[model samples]
Structures are given as structure tokens and as C-alpha cells.
Target: MSDTTTPEQLADDAVVVDVREQDEWDAGHAPGAIHIPLGELPARLDELPEADERDPLPIICRSGNRSGKAVAWLTQQGFDAANVEGGMKQWAFAGKPVVTDSGADPQVI
Candidate 1:
């Protein structure tokens, strides 16, 4: 797997998955992120876009820890996944755009 990507480094093909709970997702998450909620990931894998087993994906959570496990599991399953390093907390600290309210509006810090 590749290294984690920063908001500025996110490419068109880079998929961002948010593993936080639904309430956390409603509060705020990276713009363009797809919510899968950690607990539901196994059943929801089909919801993810098709990717090469080795293509990179950056997973985010409220903090970095949960995303690390996500990354590990995905990688073991032959899907290339990277933890967001600092997750949404870092994204917020860096003042990147976050999408709330069904993405009707984006909050940019």
C-alpha cells in the first residue's frame, strides 16, 4: 500500500472512506468521503467502488487509531488501504473542507 494522502494530495482516483459512526459522520467529515461506519464495513464492502487489489485507499475516522485497523484489515484482504494518519482531527486542524448536511453545503475552515 502507499502512504497516506493529505487533503491537497487527494487525487481524482483516490477514494476516501470514513469509518466513523453515523452521528460522527453527520457532525463532519472530509469532503467527498463515503461513510461506511466501522461496524457495518463487512456487510457494506460491496458499496465501495471497485478497485484493484493494490490500488490505494485512504480511510479516515474520528481519530487515526480506528482507521489504522481498517487499513490493516483491508490490506490483508488484498485491497490496498492507507490510514489517514491523523484522520478527521488532522483534516479539521488543517482547515480542509468538510461536507455535512448531505453535502448540500461544504464547511471550509
Candidate 2:
């Protein structure tokens, strides 16, 4: 299978890393997804799930663009990673839960 994944393909509990900006993340994100802005991914590598745990860690952003870049960089570092196709927009549209830190109604920003 390709390294890009649509939100519906993932299990509800699938582990994911969201690489959007702080404000974007605060607006809405996949419930339970790890928040690691694209710029901070390098320093937060140790906080990621085990390299083999998820087989290929799923990375997301507001759109697929940033996560695609993240996947490329992570692949070069020998970390298995995949971009979430269509990103948060698709994830929310697919009926998956979006959550905010403040417990407000979630909507993709």
C-alpha cells in the first residue's frame, strides 16, 4: 500500500502525529493524536511512538502538504512515517472525532 492514508482507513485508536501550528492545533485535531508541530518534530523525536509500534507513524496537518514534508524528512532519518491524506479536513469529514484543549465543539481550522 502507499504511504499516504485516508482518515477512514485508520482505526479509531490509531496513533497519529499532527504537525500543524499551535493555533491550528488548538482549533481542532484528531482526538488522541500527538501534537508535534512540523518545526518541533526533530527535537521531539524521542516523544514519538516506537519506530516499530505503529509500523509507519501517521503524520497529519491542516492539509497533506506539511505532513508530506514531515514524512520525507522522517524517512531520511530512518523513521517509518506516512502522511495522512487530506489531513484534518478529511479526518473530520470522515466522521472521526476532532477535539480541542478547551472542550469546545471541534471544527477543522
Task: State which candidate has the highest lDDT.
Answer: 2
Flag clash pairs in model 1: none
lDDT of 1 by residue, 1-109 (tens): 4456565556533468989887788877775788898878888888876654664778888777878888788778777777887778777777676768776554322
* TM-scores for every predicted model: 0.79, 0.92
Cα lDDT over the full model 2: 0.87
Cα lDDT, model 2, residue 82: 87
Q: Which residue pairs in candidate 2 collide?
A: none
| Global fold similarity of model 2 (TM-score) | 0.92
> Backbone clashes per model, in order?
0, 0
- Per-prediction RMSD in angstroms? 3.4, 1.8
Give the per-residue lDDT of model 2 (tens digit) for 1-109: 3388789888776779999999998888887699999999999999998745646888999879999999999988888898999999999888998889999877889
Q: Which ten residues in a row have the lowest lDDT in candidate 1?
A: 5-14
Per-residue lDDT of 45 in model 2: 94
